[model samples]
Target: MFVESVVRWGAWSILLQFGLGVSAGFCPPRCACRPDTMEVNCSGKHLTSVPESLPSDMKRLDLSQNKLKTLGRRQFLGLTQLQEMDLSDNVISMIEVEAFQGLQNLRILCIKNNRLKIIPVGVFSGLFSLQFLDLSENEILVFLDYTFRDMGNLQLLEAGENDLVFISQRAFTGLQNLQELNLDRSNLTSIPTEALSQLQSLTRLRLLRLTISSLPNNVFRRLHRLRSLLISHWPSLDTLASNSLIGLNLTSLVISRSNLSAVPYSALRHLVYLRYLDLSYNPITSIQGNLLGDLLRLQELHLVGGNLLRIEPGAFRGLTYFRVLNVSSNQLTTLEEGAFHSVGNLQVLRLDGNPLACDCRLLWVVRRRFRLNFDGRQPTCLSPDMVREREFQGFSEKELPRVFICRPSRIIDRRRQEANIEEGTNILFSCKADGDPAPTITWISSQKTLLSPTGRIRVLSDGTLEVRYAQVQDSGMYQCTAGNAAGNDTLSVSLQVKGFPRNRTMPFFTEQGWIESSFPPTANSSAQVANPYPFDAKTLIIATTMGFLSFLSSVAICFVFMFFWSQSKGQIKHTATIDFVPRASMGGGGEGGDTGRFTMKLI
Candidate 1:
């Protein structure tokens, strides 16, 4: 009996040791034992669904890229100790209500890229400790009110890239602990301000690709804690009011592809601690002089593809700590002499895709910069005919040949040189003449009066004269006489006053003492003749006598012919009979009759 008792006690001790080993995850491969640790890595097993009968003590379960279609009731009932689960890239279609009933300790759940169409009420009923939930890239078309009511501890939510068109106002009522939310690339036109006002703990939000035209100025007033924002591809947003981002702690902001025309300096005044600003892919033309004055702590600024034409002289006068400045892909033609004077600590400068004009002024600046040459050749000059075709690589300040030779002064009339001018207006006389000591313009009026009024006619350093507005009194012969150390030349112009005709009722010559009978006198007339036009007295008398003589001569020739014909009618008839009969009888008789008639006529 003693030996039998000893053997039984040894067997009982061995059984107790085996039980403890299995509970600590030292069990054999074929055993169905629970492990003490929370990690359950079931990767690369080609499993279609969450393995059944998992340890109740597991805190994390990763069933990624699987073929899990649905999660019915009691599917996760055994995982009461689970805290996080990753089911991304899976075939999850439907999740039954209360499917996670036993997972009261779950905190993080990621079921992104699934086929979830609807999230029924109480789907997460028992996950009271859920904190982070990501359902992004799903086909979720509908979600019930209070769908996440049981998840009071939810801290972060991501529902972007889904077909959700409407969100109930109270859908997130119980998620008071939520902080970060992403609804990017969703079909949201406008977000109810109240819906987002309830998220007191939300400190960050991303709403990329939401075709929102404009946001109410007070849209972000309730989000006092929001610090980071990203808004892209909103083509209709052109202007942002100054108070649009009021009452928010925005630190980092990105707004791209917005087709903006100009940056409102007031829009960024409230962002005191902003560090990163991106204004790329906009149609911005110029930056205001005081644009970056208030952004003292700005670190990175991107102005790519913004169609910038000119940067004002003091544009960035106050941004002393700007570390990275990107002004690439712009239409910048000229950079003012001291454009970037105040940017002392600017570390990186990107001037690529900018058609820089490498003139004498800009040549030295580009040569001193570290990376000005984007390609092998230096930027080409777009100014001054001499160095226009020259590149920056082969040219240097010392090598740039002698001073521009001033051509001899050539006078040009201001009236004729100007292509188009109004009819009645008087133009200021001026000429551009290149000479050794520069040119001096003097105006000489038609009455030989010199216009020497210092204030009225002032000359600029470049020799452009701004003649004060001229009047009809000022219209007369004006000359622009330019002289230098060399010889001088004068350009003359006659300025005529333009007005309507004097008399509208009578002929213009009548008012000038012209009359119809007032004719020029000949040598015989005693009255003196001043002018003669169309007809003078002597010419008129000569023309009348010649016309009368021609008429009398024509009448006399016709009268003589008629008188002779009347007086010789019978003789004419006898001669005609003799001439006709004799001619028919004999040729000699016809000849003798013809000769007698000829002799009578001659006599």
Candidate 2:
């Protein structure tokens, strides 16, 4: 009985050792396996293929940053327990269908930083439970139709930094639960309104480094649930249509580093619930009055680095709950008191990195320095030699007058000016003002818009308004306000541009009354008029057809002429000869009536 018991115990111990050995054998080479957590990591292993013999019960696997060239079919078929997998930062160019067939539980998958040019349909067919997908930093040219139809639960997708030029309409058909999507750094000239509208639950959409020039009206109307819109690096973006955001209920709107020269008052009127507004890093020179009158709920406004030179009175007329205002890193020398008359509840105000001239124009701000928040960086003076770099907070109420001293501005040539000229005429209006601290000049158009440096109408450095090729639309009263720290002055000039008949050639008349010809003779004396257009296929075809027709006509005329001449040669010939007697014999018959006999012969 003792011998039998020893043999049975030995057999049980051997079986236990074999089970332990089998568990260790399942872990692939150069991989770290945690049996307790059921996870495997073979990342950065220079792996050319998915490691084999991985634990089937592994819930998470990372194979990122390797030399993987392709993900073959059934690469992770047996890893049914994998809830998260990362194959990012590899040279993976091709992913066969069913690569993750059995990974039904995969909630997060990353295939970022690869050479994937196209995400073929069915490549992600079985990932029904995928929630987060990262396709960023790839060479994807276009998102094919139904590429992600199975990923209905996808919440976030990062497809930025790709070479995408177009997206199929049905590419995101089944991704109805996608919320946040990023397509930054793409070459799409316009928004993919159709494909993106499929994500009914999308809230935040980001598009950067695009080439879109203008936002059309109601372009985002289909995005009912969109809340946040961020656009940046759009160099060609300039105009924002009045109704561009008509149907958008966006709470936050950010547009920066663009070519927006003016505030989009018409578009912003629809965003009543918008809280944060950022137009930083644009070329906007002035903030027109009543621009943000409708955005009553707006709390924060940032125009940092907007090159703002002027903020007209009533610029922020309707914002009662305004909290923070950042206009730092700009060219603003002085801000008028009326500019912030409506924003009485203003809390944080940033005016640093600006040339704030200490004068009467800015006295109201200095008096309220204690109440206003400068965001830890106070406004400093750039003029008045004594306080060139001094902060406004440094001076007290009693010392304010002695430190920030300046004379009020007055329009020396203030007068009711008028000019009448035909269209296509160059005109100039000069505005002269006098003050202790020279005031800046800003021209306001008849449409209540600030005129910046444009190719046609430009404001010279000496406050001269130069309007080239003036049109009828240029007619109106132009208000030019010159302002400094002390105060400001205004001068209004009425410009009436008469429109000539369209068919009539518009004259090129200068401000000096010189009549320049509209069609100036070319300097080059070449007989051929310079063709500004390139040779296209149509032009080539026309030229060839004309030449062929000319050749045929010439050949036809030559043939007809030859046939007539040959036929005439076969006709009978007739010759007639008439001979007269000697003139002396004829004269002998009668001196007055000398008649000679005529004879005709036919042969």
Candidate 3:
């Protein structure tokens, strides 16, 4: 009986030890744990504190979508094997300094979608192996200096979509190997140029929703290796400094949905290797001349939903390898063929959603419509009552002559304009014309100088000629010439400055007509005419000059008489004869043109 009891006890002891081993490896309550894979998923649990009894050997922990409000120090003390932790979408507002301490193997930490107003330093301490850190979608207002100083191996940081206004210059100090940083959709007043330059290995940056008006010079000189940059939704952005992007070797750049009124030609002249550019939803009214000649390797260009009126010839002169162009949803009536002649390598052309006139100006596009891909939305006619709403490619070549007709540019108000203006006053000449393709108005000055948009004489935006502080030299027939591909028209505007200067200070009209003065008038000097005095201004000048000459001759005679009397007193026999030689005898000139000689013989 004693042997039987001892054996039974030994069997029970073995079974109890086996049960204890299985209990140690059991899954936590209300949690799914794959002990084989070492991952714990406790997401969406309503418990306020961190889930208890998490597997000790788990490599990934997801505690997101919980009501946890604060993270206490040493909360995750034993999670040494954790390689990734997701604490996003929680009401976490405060984080003790040592909350994530000893997470040396954590490679990814995401604290997004939280109510974090500030992330004090030392929160990310001892995370030596972390590669990606996401602090986006939070209420963080500022990033203190050295906030991420301990995360030396961090490679990517996404802190966009936050209420960030100011960031310390050393906020990203130790992130030397960081390659990508995104601060898009934030309320940053300006680009944190100094703060971002510390990332020595940064290659991509995104900054959107800025409120700056102009980019100062050399803003990106320190970000030397940046390859792609995206800047959008800056409605107040207008002027981009010419040297703003001087040091970057960017391959792609985007500046969209802004208030830019024209192509920043001078600003983009140095982006020689830039291949992709996007300038969509801007207020750019036109693209004129060879403005984009410097972008040699450009492959794609975008200018969608803009206010484009016309694209002048040679606009794409040097984009030899250009492949795609998108200028949809604009106000262009027609595109002159020369606009795309230099872009022969174009494969995809998007010119739809525009008010096309279906005129001869767009025949070149219709001829090549079959060869070029329109990207689903083809060009549609908006004019020529018969062809309105008609597809561009539907029209046959035989039907083009009647539908695609052009009208020669003509001066609607064809009459010579004559005006008399006073000096020191501003004057404007109005010229009106019409044509199939809008005509360009040019004004030629009386001095045969082309009137530009600046200087004393200039052309206004409405094609009116403005002369500021008019002078007498500006008083002549000014020509207003309007020309286009169809034809040309011209009219003369006769401007007479100070026509009746002695009468009044302001120019006035007369009953007969604009009386042309045969010559510049002088003060009345005729004796027959009733005058204030016979010696008027001009008459007095001549009389005074003649009297002064006679006085000079009398003084000479007195000198000659005095010299002879002195010689007689000395009993000197002085016989002096002065003879003058003509300049003709000495040829055209002598030394310094001073050959007028006289000789006096004294005996």
Full ranking by lDDT: 2, 3, 1
Candidate 1 residue-wise lDDT, 1-603, digit = tens: 999999999885664445333232333222223344545655444567677566666677777776778888867886777898888888889888888888888889999998998999988888888888999999987556788888778888998999877777777778788888888776666765667777778877887777777766777767887888777888877767678788877778888888678876777888888888888888999976766778877887788898898787677777766677677779885554455645446666665567765433353345555544233433455545566655555564465434222334556544453312322343554566655434566766556766664554444454444444333354555567787433687776655543322221111223454222322343444554347578889999999999999999999999999998888865443322222323445434433343222212322
Top candidate, metric TM-score: 3
Residue pairs in clash, model 1: none
Candidate 3 per-residue lDDT, tens place, 1-603, comes to 999999999985764433221223544555666544666777897758886666566788888998889998878887788899999999999999988887889999999999998998988888889999998999999999999999889989999888998999999899988999999777778778888889888888888887878888887767888889898899999999989888888889899998999999888888887999999999999998888889998889999999998888888887888888899999988888787645458788888999989887887778788988999888999998889999978988889888887888887886767878767678888888899777889999898878999877899987899987676778998999988877899988988886333433433224763233333334642223336776679888899999999999999999999999897787665565565655654446554543354556685
TM-scores of the candidates in the order shown: 0.59, 0.69, 0.73
User: Which is superior by TM-score, 2 or 3?
Assistant: 3
For each of the candidates, the C-alpha root-mean-square deviation to the true structure, in angstroms, is: 20.4, 15.1, 18.9
Candidate 2: where are CA atoms >4 Å away? Answer: 1-25, 341-343, 409-433, 436-603
The regions of model 1 sitting more than 4 angstroms off are: 1-38, 42-49, 142-144, 360-603
lDDT of each: 0.67, 0.85, 0.83
Q: Model 3 segments beyond 4 Å from truth?
A: 1-24, 35-37, 410-434, 446-448, 453-480, 488-603
In candidate 1, where is summed lDDT lowest over 10 consecutive residues? 500-509
User: What is candidate 1's local distance difference test score?
Assistant: 0.67
TM-score order of candidates, best first?
A: 3, 2, 1
**Going through the candidates in order, what is the number of backbone clashes in each?**
0, 1, 0
Best by lDDT: 2
Candidate 3 pairs with clashing backbones: none
lDDT winner, 1 or 2 = 2
